[model samples]
Target: MTIDSVRGAPEPELVQLLTPEGERVEHPDYPLDVTAEELRALYRDLVVVRRIDLEAVALTRQGELGIWASLLGQEAAQIGSGRALGEHDMVFPTYREHGVAWCRQVEPLNLLGLFRGVNHGGWDPAEHGFHLYTIVIGSQTLHATGYAMGMQRDGVLGTDRAGATIAYFGDGATSQGDVNEAFVFASVFNAPIVFFCQNNQWAISEPLERQTRIPLYKRAQGYGFPGVRVDGNDVLACLAVTRKALKDAREGQGPTLVEAFTYRMGAHTTTDDPTRYRLKAEEESWKLKDPIERVKAYLVRNQLADTSFLDEVDAEAKQVATALRKACLDLPDPRPLAMFEHVYAEPHPLMTEEQERFAAYLASFEEASA
Candidate 1:
């Protein structure tokens, strides 16, 4: 389907609270009551998250990271939804959600460790309420669904103290059977979970047309839940929509699908080349709708933040990037045998034998050197 066709007819118009020129607008269904201080904080979040993403991309090019999935244009989508989350809410993220990880108070170094080949996950998930990154496409959705069901069984639903779960995936994941199954389970059980799909225009090299003819959020209607498409570049809209969806889930209103309509400004990952499949014109058009630039413009136009504040934020971003670089380079590489250590909960004879043989092989190398 062409962009004009999708934007024109059967699908609903995108929900937006902030214009590309930085003017704030009102939404009847999704209202926001943000203070000036909170708005400034959101701007800080967008700046820092973008910096972290750019730094990771640079590090991957420098051979510090094996690969980096850059979330260049989706900062507002992530930060807005992430900040809407309550302290007890759980989040299951796909590998590219660096911005969400930041909002969860996860150290950038911990995330880098996974891509740097140091560990599967370097931090405790329970402590931060953020699960380990799932590289398998769409698998985390099922995990989030099951976790939400557990919360329901434990009588945690419909209470102020109750918490909901969020499943972060991409446009590509919506095509996966696992994600569809997750939707079925969540709907039938009336589970308190939010399915946040960041439709970044392209899923790898494939255009969104390859995924579905209809807008993705519309799929939720068939499964018996409400779905809304929001201007992912507009942080205010994303924040308002997500906060409302999450609140509904907490009140036992059931699952909601939040389609964050945004763009992927960079390649799918450090290794891929967008030039191979996408046009330069398309990229240029998105530059004008950049998430960070609009937020910065809004802050300046309203005098909520001055030049000195912006300069300070920029300096702070530089420090964060520098620290991330140092942490990535300083990480210790795991031993070859470390991979087999967690293969099973209890020791097995075959694994034991393999470990022994591997140890003997290393010993022989030392003996020869000596």
Candidate 2:
């Protein structure tokens, strides 16, 4: 059954700039003026990020990674929202936010290492303005709320130099107490944050219908914050809506909940079998609304990008996949004791003692073997 049928209600109006047929439509509320160059760049971002995702899935299948969460059909929701962030803005992302990580300049290899059990996303969050992926259901929302409050206290809110924070979560996370608590805190404190929810239709096996009776975005209204639903498949609409939301937060307008209504075209992760719960026909229907293909069509229809440009993008995607594979293969396994090293900022006596004891234990193994 389609998501609309599951809701048993009419689908709410979504902010859309592009139709499934590749025709660009105008939205009075969210106006987006993009040049040909910008369009090309956005298309490139979508294509490259998708390639990286595909490669990661391939690696997992090849036993290079223990597990991987695929973002097969949520490219526009991610890349569009990711690209909307300001340079100084911070982002808290869920485990499946590889696309946002890419926009934040976190290398794909760093993500691969996390899945491979080598390290906890080797890149520093402060350096990249992107927090490490949060595997917990919805805890990152609290972290983002706290950080945004911190920014407000630091006298950064309502300024031209304001740096807003965005917390990325899925539809499933909305049900978590942590997410609800975050909304309350953000609203009461007027935290300069944007809660970007990529509602990809399924939170694992549970469909969107099971998550809530009303639409996900509307949940924000009760919390006293503005909420918007955007066509997650339309990259331009996502970009426009997110840009406005971030701008509003920076200007001290408080939190905004942006629901990017999209679908998951593949299994939730490499470990999932979508065929068991969702219908094959449903998947085929969403395929027609493919985000990348729409952008390509728009480009081709306008004669902005010819076959040569398309071929170049495909070639570039292959090169990126090659580099990512090499990087993943070259990663060295961390020593067993490495995990204890970064547990605290300053070395504590108890930790040091434990580390020594662990070292002794490891040494005893070598002695026994000898």
Candidate 3:
């Protein structure tokens, strides 16, 4: 496939198997075969993550947290993409990927360390089979690329191992040189990685138009990969598309790009004033297509879940929020010496020297003040 420099000019082979109106649809290319239990788990994931996100935002507003990047409307995209990963697959995330982080078994409140200005990372990647959320935009792409390349070199991708790598980024990240470079690397080497772009239509105040004239997934042809767009608000569509993409990559079919077309229903961050840039009408529009509501409607229409289940879910949501609020408040700040770990694999000479200097300076302050 020759790369096209133009937008929306690429043929529409992308798959979307569900609609925002709580109805099942089909795409000839991507078929979904999931059980009821799977759907219920997906619903649970979306609910609990959204509740945690809402609590985090409230905490920020109430001064319980330093800041938060809420994943209000993008939970389906993140959780579905997360579910697509096999147990062996590894994940890399950006700072805003709390939804994905939650899916990977990392507690929601663990993310507060960085926002609270206490640490470089929230948790060890090895513990959760995920990398520390990188704050620098699009940087995780290279890490994912490198990891995939390593997997290829190990001959892992040559076999049907059900293992691959995934990197999550946002629409604004698509413009970064690192992202494009990652594409170049993945395409050239046929790396078994998925570049999952949550195109929630806004890169801060910048609209989707600012970054590309064409659809993001269509742009992947230039890099020698198939790209698909899903109804990110429809969790089932996200699951179907991402599962196929990861399967293709793991089967040595090379990389794929998934553009989860969703929306961000909140400010870019706790510090942001989105009202200053976007229209109130747009938020209202997306709210009507709420991911959680769509799923709830589907479950009720199909009798997969009843009002009692939903009420129970609602109660559980509140419990989750309360637990997260307490966790954020109770989390201890990082120890003074805990800062010296994880900057590098080997002992970093410069960091060691700085740590000593910092210790000396702190000691001098106490001596002088005393």
- Name the best candidate (by TM-score): 1
Deviation (Å) of 188 in candidate 1: 0.7
Error of 3 at 338 (Å): 3.6
**TM-scores of the models, in the order given:** 0.96, 0.96, 0.92
The Cα error of candidate 2 at residue 341, in Å, is 1.0
* Candidate 3 lDDT: 0.85
Order the candidates by lDDT, highest first: 2, 1, 3
Residue-by-residue lDDT tens digits, candidate 2, 1-370 = 5555454778788999999889999999899999999999999999999999999999999999999999999999999999999977999999999989989889889999999999977898999999999999999999999999999888976676789999999999999999999999999999999999999989999988788878889889999999999999999999999999999999889999999999988888899999899899989999999999999999999999999999999999999999999999999989999979778899899989999999999999999999
Go through the candidates in order and give the C-alpha RMSD of each one to the true structure.
1.6, 1.7, 3.2
Give the clash count for model 2: 0
Write the number of the candidate with greater lDDT, choosing between 2 and 3: 2
Which model is ahead, 2 or 3, in terms of TM-score? 2
lDDT of 1 by residue, 1-370 (tens): 5743775765577899999999999999998999989998999999999999899999999898999999999999999999999987999999999999999999999988999988878878899999999999999999999999998888978776799999999999999999999999999999999999999989899899889878899999999999999999999999999999999998889999999999999999999999999999999999999998898898899989999999999999999999989878998989978978878999999999999999899899999999
Error of 2 at 296 (Å): 0.2
* Total backbone collisions, model 1: 0
